[model samples]
Target: MAYAMLEKFEKYWGDYSTLLAIVIVLDPRYMMVLVRLAFSKLSIPVEVEASIKEIYDTLVKMYKF
Candidate 1:
């Protein structure tokens, strides 16, 4: 399941990356919401949620500046 989600994320990352960047720059709170929704939609496990949160948090912090 995690592998499937990663595959799907990898496929969309190129397209979503720009939008995510923009969101992070303009509004990090929204980026967090988007990340949470994406992960929820992917049915990510609770164990993996921490890593996803970490990644999104980093992205938000990196781009929010």
Candidate 2:
């Protein structure tokens, strides 16, 4: 049971749901810090910088549209 829960957690941590991330970033209290913290918690190291940059770019694109 513990293993199953851990596996589920790892999967969730490793993947970023774009819309959810965007919403989180929009909040001043959290912003990118929360995203960075989430990725940091994952067992596997993810390229967080690029992902964050992409998110920023996406946000700008969305605003400009």
Candidate 3:
């Protein structure tokens, strides 16, 4: 299931990245919350929270500077 989601994400990564970039520009904290909700909906394990946090942190850094 996770692999399936990852495949789909890869297929649409460009679009998703663009959207995330825009959203991060508007508000990175909110973007992180949205990412968390998205992963939760996908049934990502709580154990992967750190990985998600890293992604959110990177996104924040990209938008902040």
Please report the candidate that would top lDDT against the real structure: 2
Every model's TM-score: 0.36, 0.69, 0.38
Report the Cα lDDT for residue 5, model 1. 94
Residue-level lDDT tens digits of model 2 in 13-44: 66777788899999999998998787666524
lDDT of 3 by residue, 1-65 (tens): 99999898767642335355346546846655666666565544773485476676776777799
Can you write out model 1's per-residue Cα lDDT over 1-65, one digit (the tens) per residue? Answer: 99999888778652334345345545746655666666566545793476465666766777779
* Candidate 1 Cα misplacement greater than 4 A, ranges: 1-29, 56-65
- By lDDT, highest first, what's the ranking? 2, 3, 1
Poorest stretch of ten by lDDT in candidate 3: 13-22
Highest TM-score among the candidates is held by which one?
A: 2
What are the Cα lDDT values of the candidates? 0.59, 0.79, 0.60
List candidate 2 stretches off by more than 4 Å: 1-7, 43-46
C-alpha positional error of residue 38 in candidate 3 after TM-score superposition, expressed in Å = 0.8
Q: Flag the better candidate by lDDT, 1 or 2.
A: 2
What value does the lDDT take at residue 51 in candidate 2?
74
Model 3 local distance difference test score: 0.60
TM-score of 3: 0.38
User: Would you list the rank order by TM-score, best first?
Assistant: 2, 3, 1
